[model samples]
Target: MEKLDVLVLLDVSGLEDKEKFEKHLKKEGFHTVPDEAFVYTAESSTTTFSTKAYILEVFKKGLQKNTFLDANLIFLLNETPYPAYYYDKNSNDFELSESKEAI
Candidate 1:
């Protein structure tokens, strides 16, 4: 379904990890936008799942780009190519997680 605006893409439904991420972002004084976005993603043509894509931008950058980044955190999952956690301050770069376990 069409993403509920670009800001709502960060909504992680009811996942506890998502909640913790949200709280952590807020604790860091970062402003997060809710982006409950879903894309009909397909892998190998036959495998597909309506997965969620989330992004966060610092308040300053969000104002310039009209998008926000998840300040000090990113929504993580095990299926992706990199570790499930990371810290990305630069809006245009992807920084992978350093620890194997969530700290």
Candidate 2:
């Protein structure tokens, strides 16, 4: 399998502890991008689970711990301009509502 590129968009505007949140993401191996986006690329051979799924799990746990509050996240696979799964804060879960054909 090919490496999958993941992008996580965090809403940090007006948050007092934004730096701490950013640090947490970086500690988890995400690189910062412009506009509150953090990125990570996963090599398929190195991990047993799907890259997107793993990232989502990380985000979910982070959210539960208030690491990313008032934030909505989306997972984009392989550098695509669209999201494969979006985090639903109300439900605290990732929803795969995007069409694969869009990729």
Best by TM-score: 2
Worst 10 residues of 1 by lDDT: 39-48
Per-residue alpha-carbon lDDT of model 2 for 1-103, expressed as tens digits?
5555665554333344555655666666666776544443433333334566667776666556554435445555555554455556678786765564322
Please estimate how well model 1 matches the true structure, expressed as its whole-model Cα lDDT: 0.33
How well does model 2 score by local distance difference test?
0.55
Candidate 1 residue lDDT tens string, 1-103: 2322211222222332444444444553434543432211221211113122223233223323333434223332223432333435464544445765432
TM-score for all models, in order of appearance: 0.26, 0.56
The pairs that clash in candidate 2 are none
Predictions in order: lDDT: 0.33, 0.55
* Cα displacement (Å) at residue 36, model 2: 4.5
Which stretches of candidate 2 lie above 4 Å from their native place?
11-16, 34-49, 67-69, 81-90, 96-103
